[model samples]
Target: MNTTPTIDVPVQVLSGPTVLIEYAGLRILTDPTFDEPGEYPVMPGYAMTKTSGSPLGTDEVGRIDAVLLSHDEHDDNLDRSGRAFLPRVPVVFTTISGAGRLGGNAKGLAFWDEATLTAPDGTVVTVTGLPARHGPEGSEPVSGDVVGFLLTAPGHPSVYVSGDNASLDYVQQIADRCAPIDTAILFIGGVRHKPMLDAQLVTIDNTQATWIARALQARRVIPAHFEGWAHFQGTREDLTRTFEEAGLADRLTYA
Candidate 1:
């Protein structure tokens, strides 16, 4: 269960990494993986199994102004169904390599680069790409390049979206550059695959999520990408318990 909106902005976690962040009348989506429970061969020997599907389909999630895809290499981030839905969005923001692969309405954002989106009434929203490490240090070659996102508008609370990032150092870096965040959408699952990087934390774990809140000095926190897949080792209860034990439960919310 979630308490009332702390920032008054609607942040909904649909499933997996898929989230709808409505800011200043602009709808922004993150890592759209809408496929039903199934199996995907991530590596030759490693397979990912989705235990549940999204409650809302693409049609139901109407009017997305942009998609902040962390990366396109992983199935958990962008599945078949999600790939098909990208064209409908006005713009899809992702890594440079992903933009070339996705093409058509997909624009790439390098680290610290800013992209803008306009609403029907000409309200502008700024989206900035942030550095994201998918696994332990020096794991980029195997983990591939991932990116987090930061959104800002004139009066709306700033939102930081951590996309499959595992490093607290990177979070600290973001804090130094853009601290006092109003809302943070953390992707935390403690995901692990024995075949990859000696099985390290692929994303922020429950405890780490709490640290992220502190690092960013965030007023409100919403978690995503923590469940619905076999590789996810953390549970919602674990996340809630972690925050509660840390005396930060008032900052946690679910949609």
Candidate 2:
């Protein structure tokens, strides 16, 4: 039996890359993709297809204080419908380029940069932008700039949100800077696009996720971005087996 305890904060995986996190008096979201199952043309000969949409969309999940967008370029992270939902939010934190492209309440953050959000009851949450590599090293030009986020407060558990990072070196950088992450929301799919990256893994696989859990010594790890798209290959069972084999099953939670 899985003996992992409950996560201090409330986290609900809406499907794919989207997640809802309730911290203290704050409501935060990540990479909202609300589009139904369909094929979207990203480039002339390239397309991404969604297999299914989440049961709950933006309207159902009310009162979002902020959105931690990994990147706005990809349809999987911010689909056409999700783009429409941005204006309704109070603040959006994303990469510098993404913020420039998406103005109006969207704030740009570089690696190691920080943003602040105040809760209703005089609580403050600090959001830090961290580095993320979508594919192999030096693939930014093709993959575009992606970002991760770290949420921290005076007395709250530290939470790390790994966007679409594939490189453990970058993750190690994060662990070195801030260890003992209380909660981690990892976007692992092990997705591969042969034409795009020549069949190279574009996202963290199950083994990498387990390594992250151990490296950060995370109490709870709620996974996302592992399904809903045809390109996604990592499954929950695969991740469970990997974590169990690594002796870190207790840290894995499907919250």
Candidate 3:
């Protein structure tokens, strides 16, 4: 058996846009929304369906190390059941607004703040917060501060987890200022109300993910948040096609 202590990351699609990331022998849950199954129309009224994607039963997941929640939307991220499991875990990293929403049990951290946490084998895992946006175009005052994360293992290539982003500008900026990224786990679904709107409806979609992969020149790209929700419309097929069409099929991998 290969006994190298490397970060082998895997993305498990729970339900619309909700992803479970397994890395470094630890589980990281993102936007854990176990909404009642069915189709729900997007408030502000964009799409059809009250909800979709079967709810990942409480016992469905295992070993949740940390949570990289972007916002405090119940539909997109964080459900009642998910929150109940928070206090059981040692650390829960999320946005300030979400911290409040997560109640006093979970500690809050700012975007770009790097915190070191212990892994299963006592390995020091460095978690760095990366900036993210809810919607595309300009930032609205109403939305909360949503951010991604950069995890660096001692003997492994660094991994970047994009929570929910609509723009590649922030990704490019992160790639430029910080150290080089080896594997980037992007939330790709391109779930939008219209073709011309932003993609953070759940993920950055195909076009933006492509832009980021090229900009950062990352080695491996894992797509998430594409095939889980009722509101989410983008698919892994869409991302694959876009990357292939863009001549980036080899670089972008679907997890």
Candidate 4:
């Protein structure tokens, strides 16, 4: 048996879906949204309200080696300031459609597609795109395309970042393909938009997050996108309660 030291990666949740992941001497930012709390119009009457500002500002974030953007169409994921910040990053990995829409250092990957990036210490990190759905089965037409991400390195534990998925079936598929995920960063908000689809959830809720943790058998579960927005129906307390009830509270991590 080959024994290698496991590299511990540090994940810091700034706000909402924006997180700073430090691994292999590299800083990776996810779904950068630094705009102040305000109302962002999505459709004619539909608007997404931001309730909180990111703890860290773009200037404080310093240099970002790469970005793992699930999708860019929504302001909650990538706000006005985030769009402006993308051009500065060295590389950005997002959905194929989003890439096409956003050129310039932006690369798109289909589900299961992989990309390799070299860290400052010459460590090669393999990032693979995973499947995700923003809404119900037939909601893609209006919901657009979203993608999750998986990170793997030689000595680092594998990490899964679920962007905006709502379906448990998709989670099952991910579990079957990539079981025993060491760290799982799930986007939970239970977002609802009545004008769009009768207030159906646009992302996973607390119960689903608990199920996802059990399915993946994740060593660490960090929930994001559960707060800082008006549309989100779920909260960190809800997730904590669910995980506690499931006897998996030890696995939950706020940062």
Question: How much lDDT does each candidate structure score?
Answer: 0.89, 0.89, 0.68, 0.89
- For candidate 4, write residues 1-255 as lDDT tens digits: 111225446998887899899867789999999999999988887788999999888889988999999999999999999999999999999999999999999999999999999998899999999999999889988999999999888778888899988878988988998888888999998887889867788899888888999998788899888889898885677778889999999989999
| lDDT (Cα, 0-100) at 95 in candidate 3 | 77
lDDT of 3 by residue, 89-112 (tens): 667788777788677655566777
Model 4: worst 10 consecutive residues (lDDT sum) = 1-10
- Number of clashing residue pairs, candidate 4: 0
For model 1, residues 1-255, the per-residue Cα lDDT tens digits are: 121235568989999999999888888899999999999997787799999999999889988988999999999999999999999998999988889999999999888999898877777888999989999999999988889999887766788999999989999889999988888999999887788889888888898988889888888999999888988985788889999999899999897
lDDT of 2 by residue, 1-255 (tens): 111234388899997999999986898999998988999997789898999898787789899999999999899999988899999999999999999999999999999999999988888889999989899988889999999999987768888999999989999999888887889999999988888878887799898899999887788998999989988885778889999999998888897
Displacement of the residue 9 alpha carbon in candidate 3, Å = 2.6
C-alpha TM-score for every candidate:
0.96, 0.95, 0.82, 0.96
Of candidates 4 and 3, the better by lDDT: 4
Pick by lDDT: 1 or 3, better one? 1
Q: What's the residue-level lDDT of 51 in candidate 2?
A: 94
Estimate the Cα RMSD of every predicted model relative to the unseen true structure: 3.0, 3.1, 4.0, 1.9
- Cα shift from native, residue 117, model 4 (Å): 0.6
